[model samples]
Target: MELVSGLFLSKRIVYKNGTPVPLSVITKSFEELFNIKLGDCYKKHESVISRKPTKLTEFLDELRKFIIEERENKGYR
Candidate 1:
C-alpha cells in the first residue's frame, strides 16, 4: 500500500492520456489484483509518510534490498 501510494504521489505513472490516475483507482486495482483488502489507503499513506528513518520509502527500501539480494544470488549483477 505504501509503495502504491508512493508511486501515485510521485506522479511516476499516468494514464495514456497524460492525466494523473486517481488514488482510489490505483488502490482499487491493487486490491483486486492482489486479492487483498487494503482498508483505508489514505491512512496507510499517512503512516508511510510519518515513518521515521526511511521517510516515506520504508517499503521501497525493503523491496530494493530483497531485489538486490535475489539478483546477487542469481549472479545477475
Candidate 2:
C-alpha cells in the first residue's frame, strides 16, 4: 500500500476493530522494512484522508487480481 500524506492509503473494510492491533508496532515494522523513518505516520494528521470510492475500488480490484494470481500460482485456485 502507498503512504500518502503520512497515512496508509487503502480502503478499510472494517470500520472498527474489536481487538485493536498495536499501531506503533505496525509502524515500527513498516519503518524497518522500508528503511525510512515514518514519524509522520505516528502523528495525527487532519489533512490526510481516504481517496474517493471510485479510485479505491480500482485499487481493491487490482489487489484482488494479484491475490488470485498468487493463489493460482500455488495451485490453490
Candidate 3:
C-alpha cells in the first residue's frame, strides 16, 4: 500500500499520454493485481507519512534493500 501510494504521489507512473493517474485508480489496479483489498488507501498513506523517526519511505527502502541483496546473491554488480 505504501509503495503504491509513494508511486502515486511521485507521479512516476502515468498513462501513455503522460497524464498523472488518479490515486484511486492506481490503488484499485493494485488491489486487483494483488488480490487483496486496501481499505482507505488515503488513510494508509497518511499513516505512512506520519511515521516516527522520519522513516516515511520504509517500505520503499526495504524494497531497494531486497533488490540489492538479490543482485549481490546472483553475483551481479
- CA shift of 31, model 3, Å: 0.3
Model 2 stretches with alpha carbons more than 4 Å out: 1-19, 42-49, 57-61, 73-76
lDDT of 3 by residue, 1-77 (tens): 77888889899989999999988889899999999999898888788878985687777789899999999999998
lDDT of 2 by residue, 31-52 (tens): 7998977675535222233556
TM-score of 2: 0.41
Ranking by TM-score: 3, 1, 2
lDDT of 1 by residue, 20-75 (tens): 88887888899999999988888877777777874667668899999999999999
Per-residue lDDT of 65 in model 2:
96
Off by over 4 Å in 3: none
Number of the top TM-score candidate? 3
Displacement of residue 36 (Cα, Å) in model 3 is 0.5
Regarding TM-score, does 1 or 2 come out ahead?
1
What is the C-alpha local distance difference test score of candidate 2? 0.52
